[model samples]
Target: MAPAAITLAAEAPKLSSANTGFMLICSALVLLMTPGLAFFYGGMVRVKSTLNMLMMSFVSIGIVTILWVLYGFSLAFGSSNGFIGFNSDWLGMSNVGLTELWDGYTIPIFVFMVFQMMFAVITPALISGAIADRVKFSAWALFVALWLTIVYVPVAHWVWGADGWAFKLGVIDFAGGTAVHINAGAGALGVILVIGKRVGFKKDPMRPHSLPLVMLGAGLLWFGWFGFNAGSWLGNDDGVGALMFVNTQVATAAAMLAWLAYEKIRHGAFTTLGAASGAVAGLVAITPSGGAVSPLGAIAVGAIAGVACAAAVGLKFKFGYDDSLDVVGVHMVGGIIGSLLIGFFATGKGQSTATGVFYGDHSFTQLWKQFAGVGAVLGYSLVASAVLAFLLDKTLGMRVTEDEEVSGIDQAEHAETAYDFSGAGGGVVSSVSAALAGTSKKVDA
Candidate 1:
């Protein structure tokens, strides 16, 4: 037999049960991060708006799940134009057989579908934090539905789908630096600009109501992020997944320290909120570069993102847009750092063969590609989100009444309260009033 014939005969692709099981578990883990996000955001809002925050995240799971199966997946990953994927054959996954495996992928087609579905669900939910406390729940839902279709689906296709414009152009987003983080961040900015600021933007004590809840949510996110980063490889056979997992940990740890150090130098206090925010910033920073960069590179990315995001969070104060929970600062800013720095830090040794400028490859080509990917997603998401928010605002009305917002969105929107501390006693009521008065006095002071 000729050598070529022997080589072709020696290579056979078979489905591995182990890879299937690993991916299924990874899908489940990624799904958990959405609820964890609910807690993280819920605790940041006032006690009254807590359930609404949680509801915002929870509702994405329900809405996006149905949409993803019906056609969202097709629009995102179907075989079609490079800029966008929309094949009727993939509508409702009709063309996908249960026994079918995605080409060149080790897992079943359905498993991969669900995994990407989880990502689609959470991307829009990340925008909710920017407009917390004052948004009408129904309007927010409508925005999510529209934004996902117009902005997220196209961007997801561009970055991830086979033959995607950016994918073909050599952009390297191992996870979701552009598609998820920058997309959501810019979308949040657009919606917030349309919705305007919370009633008390600069003057109120909008401090987190419960640090414990925030920490719990952060812990869940940290645990689940292993899957979020490593699972992108789609297979554990290569040591790339292992490297991603380690990079995720060390980057997050470094970020937390960097944020605390910054806070101590600037604000003179190391708040629990800083630790949690730093951890999330780190996670966002490493998502794109973790598999491509070394542990030291991860640390550098995380540390830069931590400090940059910490400072960026204050931009709302300077620019006078109320990003209620700093989603723009952490997700968007950290994402840009991670995505762009990969242009300098990526080693040609990893799964990605592209070498960075700093790796002595001495070319800015990869850097320009990164910028193009980020710019395309950011610009598209921003304009699409603004249009959606404006349409929703014009029709359904996006914000609650001023009275409803001041009193609390939970009762006005959900007809429920997060805490029933009202029924405690007469003494408790007086004490609580006095405490609030004292807080107001301090704000004035």
Candidate 2:
């Protein structure tokens, strides 16, 4: 009997090289998004603070990676209570075997761990755009560490962990509409409220210094989001990953067009910034719903989010919170729209077994469940992040001095500039001299 039991265990599903390879590629794609995000946010700030804006996003890569390896994975995914998780063996990834499968999946636990680490990396980075240009780099770093531990970890557990209350309740989050988008958006709102507004909020032009750079960043984000959305399925054994991929592209296109239309109607012109922002809004809206809805449903989700986020971005000016980059408008609003729309568009055909309000049985049960998940994450992240920012503000000081802010955060904090104008005059002089010298040679010849 003992021998037979050992043989049965040995006969369990083996590691799939295809899925493993696919996931590795997906992880790399997701990792690229942070730097892409850096460019996106960096270009939106004034020239003086470009590097600081980029640094805020880039630093999250370092901060979250170390924490994830140390204890974040365990706290997020370990089997424990529904609220939070902890496993002694997974603390340092000490006992996770190289070939050991991730429970019922064919991929190794290590592969899944690294893939998830990418998600953890980007979530905090999303919040950086909200508080850009005025934050102390050290304070922001500290906040990332603390927020990941206290807010993100538990929320991740509650949504994705096996025994999590939300997971048990059948709330469908294919990727991270709640855990990543809403959580980061709400956290951004909380911190910005505490840190106060930038130096010249409504008075300053404060326009994006480089629209081209913003477009580049948005392009990269759009490309990498394929991995972020599809990889959440964990493998290609099923067709759900393919479905997510198609839906992502469709929704993004629809949203971009929708946003441009709205911009033309509201602002009288379709701006490049509007196109980029609209695409992002679409991405955020589809992150959670892509797996559950058809391509048509994705279009609806994307179109709605695009117009909604386009309108929401203006609210900061009206209410005066000063979210530097519209993280709340795009991410929070988009995420909530996507997550809640899941209750309407889910066909019980794609990833989950649950049908939405407009589908089979026309039940509102899933809608209520989604409300629970969104409310829980939003409420907790907002309150807890505000508290964390307040504590950091009191002790280490979250904002730089007004003088440093006016002088520029890149020079004050990082001692570097995104562009070096000091050498521009010299280069111009050198170029004119070379051109004259070439003309002289030509005449002599």
Candidate 3:
């Protein structure tokens, strides 16, 4: 017994380090997704606020990072009941010791915490785009923190944490089909509804200010996704992790083509918007199913998601909601597509793993579970988000004053501009101002 105890003690440190390494990589990968989001969103907005849109992504780093270490992680992954986590304090990574729970690998629990933290940071950032160019920066910072605690942490816990009710029920959300995408999308819709539309809705051309920035952001996102999907396995080597890595690529590429095709058919041109939008839609769709589906299944999933998202985007126009940036169209719809498909497609036994209802699990049990999970997330997110917005609007103020909207949020609220044609001076100044002013005026009219 004494000899065995000594051997176990000798091996603990090596085991812990392995876990630490894996988590570090995962955290880094998730970090990259934020900048990718910047391009994905930046390219969708008019040039006037391109920097503002991109800044939303970058700002989350400063805001969510601080919140995560302070108490955000505890409220999320730390020990708690079904509602939220708080057993730990400010994550004060005490003991400088390896958490025994992760002894199965080299990464530390703190490392895992950081990896997941990046997800929490970016998910909220994704929603800011929907309400971009209109909301106050101070209000947005407060809103994100509140949303993370009230909406994100609880949903994340219920779906991903050990005692999470959804996890207990055996619901398989490989990445964040419901938790991140759908949840954030729903929340975006809620806040935008309260904040109202950008001064102009349908009249302004509002073309993307920078397609190159958009492309760069998307390319980086695609590259970093490998780590995002694979690293979720919590270990460096796992078959499921390998499977997820490949599927992410297949789905993202497939979705990109599908979006382009849809654009060509509907708009008479394959705009860069289609490329960026479709790729992200695919990524969102495959997120929950990455670890569960085969490469072929991933392609089908991505293709279908691409087409589905293309259609979903039009829902806003019909309903008159704006969804300015299509947060609802892409993330919400894509998350649903991925979540439901996984249930019907999930395989387990030697029976071709995740065989959809059509394939075998014909009972529809998986499909129902997926719907339930998604519905629960959507309902909760929308309601919680609405309440938060209402509260913030009442207490701190949600929208900028009407005068600021007319002047432009970048200059009025943020005191910053996305660009400067100063060297060219008044050469284009009169014409540009008239154009922008005309666009805003026509939008109001």
Candidate 4:
């Protein structure tokens, strides 16, 4: 007769009604980040194509949302082959029950479905920033539609889904360090290579039109990220889940501070973009380790992300590649930093148990796994994305005509303006003058 079996499981740990509500709330909060991202990217481009950027994200909601309901979830989460979900028969989930694991209080599968669909939607929209100011809206829509079918759904299934090949291979991505960040970062690079540099790129100084808009976008992204990290806990445990929530907030704050501090020390004035970008860098870094590591661990991850991402964004200068929106800099660099540094810090220590350099897993092995995951995702993503881009470029064409890019897509494609302040003033827009504006700007369209 023993007093107890004495184990982490032996303790009758409990989840709360309040916690359940909080998680559902968090899911909704994260879903909002897609629109927030739209604003973030939309505001960075020149006023000429502002609405186009906004629509990239919004259209994702329409395209991916419908696709997810049809079969995206089955391809992603249904029990099946590791590479691609073999249970295409589960397409509509004709007889599926709610999502539940050995752990209890699992949210309704439909709730989980919508939350993840938002993630799928946003990942492609993130790339639009790299190729903005060009890409015909119809072509962009078709690309996202097709890219989702090819690149995104398969990668997501391989990374996070239960039957995912990467997960089966024992790769750990707590919250899309590889799936969302690496896939998108590398995919952006492949497209940029084919799409070519921004017209004025290094040859002309193309300043961000609105730093305030950038900062606004960043603030919303940070606020929404708590849901992104904490909602992954699905079980709603206090000790582990609570730790993740606090870590997400603290790491973001620290990274933001570190970034502004770096900017102030180096550039004499802390720009809004620096602060906003810092927060995103921190959020991306902490994403992978949030559920499994501690607050202190989060700090190290955030600090490394801040410094590394800041420097990575400057790589375009040295490497001579145009990652137009710093997707490579922030997501790729930060994702790697977080994935690897966790190897050194994720110890199963008191209060923050997980095992890392402090423990005896030896940083080398853990670090290698991180790099292996990165390389695997990168290599696969580059080839696959290049193929997709080539097909699109050759068939329907992934790029806009030089003339269309110069004239801007909003007027030429949509025949609409983002803000009709002029309309509010009872003034009609000058179609001929707008037409002249498009054709006269170093373009012959």
Candidate 5:
């Protein structure tokens, strides 16, 4: 008798309708963050530069989206030996059908592509805050294009790609402590080093022109961050995603309170700016550790980052670096705090089974790994950004003219202003006319 042939059965991957819907919603939420960031930074700049600020963030959405679909996604998420993903299978998303699902993921590959695209869009936009009010819009647009290709794509590959060196080394970055926050913050510092300070740096009082806009931006950011943090799980798992959601809220609230307390004690007042800044610091701090920590751990991380970021923001005055909007302080510093603190606070109960040192694990292994990830991204982003800025300054000029900057970047770059107080008289006359028209017979007096 002939020997019986042996066969094995394997389940093929298919699209998951529920996870697909969740991811698509998450992608939309993440995309909203860019415009929310526009308002956040726009309100912080003087009114003259408001449109420029909003444009810088808005342009990233356009430039990076094109690049991501063309080759950026291939470089970031495609198959490779390691270090970088440069494969043909996913290039231009070629040969990928709408029904195709990502490996080990329940959602369609298209949904995952869009979700990650939002991340790439916002990371460079974060740098706009550091060089606010002085950069040329054209140069910025060019920089975003080049930087995403040269710096962001490679760093993202190293951190999150399946064969990524950092991933293989067991470094934990739930979302983007190293890849997004630290990368953008360090890049901001690097560019500022080359661009020099705004024309009246220390002498001028460049207070935010619109706190209401800032608060609105902050609210939008807070609402969208739920998708940002929880959705990193890539699935609607009740355990990890729910934990991340709760931790995100708790951490943000804790950071806000901690920042207000710090400001009240240090400066004798709880300013609105402090509350907004503190909330952002918390949001940044929890981005990397949210999936690995408990609600209590999130609070601890948030409070620590809030206080640390508050102190770090003042360093620009001492160090003579003109980080216009404190990106380095709140993003880079806060990212480091959150990343390193996860080494101690991780409970080994969410997402991964690896416990932190403070969770009775009794080792500094994860801490060192976190440092390695942070150091690699920071060093690379800083040096690469400085080179990009220097080349742009040499070739295209990175700064607006002194006169243009003094008057307004909105007019210089876009030929428009954010507001027209000249219309105030017309508005007042119309308001009075409406009032008079609405009045009854009492007008006899």
Candidate 6:
């Protein structure tokens, strides 16, 4: 090779330990979200279904990790015709080099691969909340595998892949509002539509068994979301990641307050559930727009999503499709609100040159593009997910027996209960008898 060519090759971006370390930490943080989600969903269900709810989220971590290593990464990030991607070398992550950097970034290909894997892990886990108590565990696992392959991989390619149609069309999803939130939310809606409602739709008094667990889960999700939103930039070379970090906090706080206010006005009380749900709504809304909008814009996104999602939760009752945990209300609606608001809040200054309607060179062009991205993902996920659920419901039986569901899916499905009431019963009786004996002795004295 000529000297000039050799020089140019040698000058290629070298490995950045700083960026690699940042991403590794970020990857760990993202992985924690699956467990966080487990706690969040687990706490929201009846005591009879708590273990099942937690397992649904936990299972996705195992299933998606294997798939992502095998061919999921290749199909998602490989070069293709803007729909799906495949590179044989990346099929098993076989040909990737440890020193090789992802194109346009300092992090290694493996780091990027694992980082994306966490995203894949949690997206399907998000759907489990909707079908909580009734679905068979085996059927749910199959759905996760198929949905990740059929629905998530392609939609991810569309929005985040280099040659993706949505990427090429200039859709601004800084994180995963369209690909993750909307996709999961729509998929939840579709599956529930097919599987029908939980046995006692209106008459049963199904309340959350544990609010403390719910609060703990929400706190974890909030803590991990900083990495989820900021680390998308791949490096801290610029201040964009920092900006995203700030926006994440601002938006979450704003959404929480907005939700509490709305609850106080509408329900006449400030409930803890509302606070947790509202914070999550803010997180979802700001996920896509944080990189493109200012802090104030993030506040707008969070507040709007908080109220909209808070109100949207009621739609399940009105429409009569049983979304046990309000996935449709919070994630789907919040994702749409966040993605579309980017067209109005984007300043063309933070992460991209594209401007929103309320920003420089105000135009509706970005808004239309946002619509296209949202509509395509939502429509495709809705249809494809329903079809997959229908096939599974017909073949393997998606739901447990009605008796199993009414009694407790944990025992029927996993052969164990979340709480051992037999021991508790004995303890309670012993205490009552001891107290009665003490009272009788005191009276004799």
Measured against the true structure, the TM-scores of the candidates, in listed sequence, are: 0.93, 0.94, 0.88, 0.86, 0.93, 0.94
Best by lDDT: 6
What is the lDDT for 381 in model 1? 88
Q: Model 6 over residues 67-126: C-alpha lDDT tens digits?
A: 999999899888876999887888989899988888767779899899999999999999
lDDT of 6 at 271: 98
Name the regions of candidate 2 deviating beyond 4 angstroms: 1-11, 424-445
Better of 1 and 5 by TM-score: 5
Residue-wise lDDT of candidate 5 within 177-288, one digit each (tens)? 9989999999999999999999899999999999999989988889888888888888885568888889889999999999999989999999999999999999999998
Pairs that collide, model 2: none
After superposing candidate 1 on the true structure, give the runs of residues whose Cα lies further than 4 Å from its correct spot: 1-12, 422-445
RMSD of 5: 6.0
Better of 3 and 4 by lDDT: 3
By TM-score: ranked, best first? 6, 2, 5, 1, 3, 4
Give the 10-residue window scoring lowest on summed lDDT in candidate 2. 1-10
For 152-188, candidate 3 gives per-residue lDDT tens digits of 9899888877767776666678778888999999999
lDDT for residue 409 in candidate 2, whole number 0-100:
93
Candidate 3 error regions (>4 Å): 1-19, 95-105, 349-355, 424-445
Following a full C-alpha superposition, what root-mean-square deviation does model 2 have from the true structure?
A: 4.7
What lDDT does each candidate get? Answer: 0.88, 0.91, 0.79, 0.73, 0.88, 0.92
Clash count for each candidate, listed in order shown: 0, 0, 14, 6, 0, 0
Candidate 4 Cα errors over 4 Å, as ranges: 1-20, 88-90, 97-105, 349-354, 424-445
Question: TM-score of predicted model 3?
Answer: 0.88
What is the Cα-based TM-score of model 4?
Answer: 0.86
lDDT of 4 at 319: 81
User: lDDT tens digits, residues 297-381, model 2?
Assistant: 9999999999999999999999999999999999999999999999999999999778898896455999999999999999999
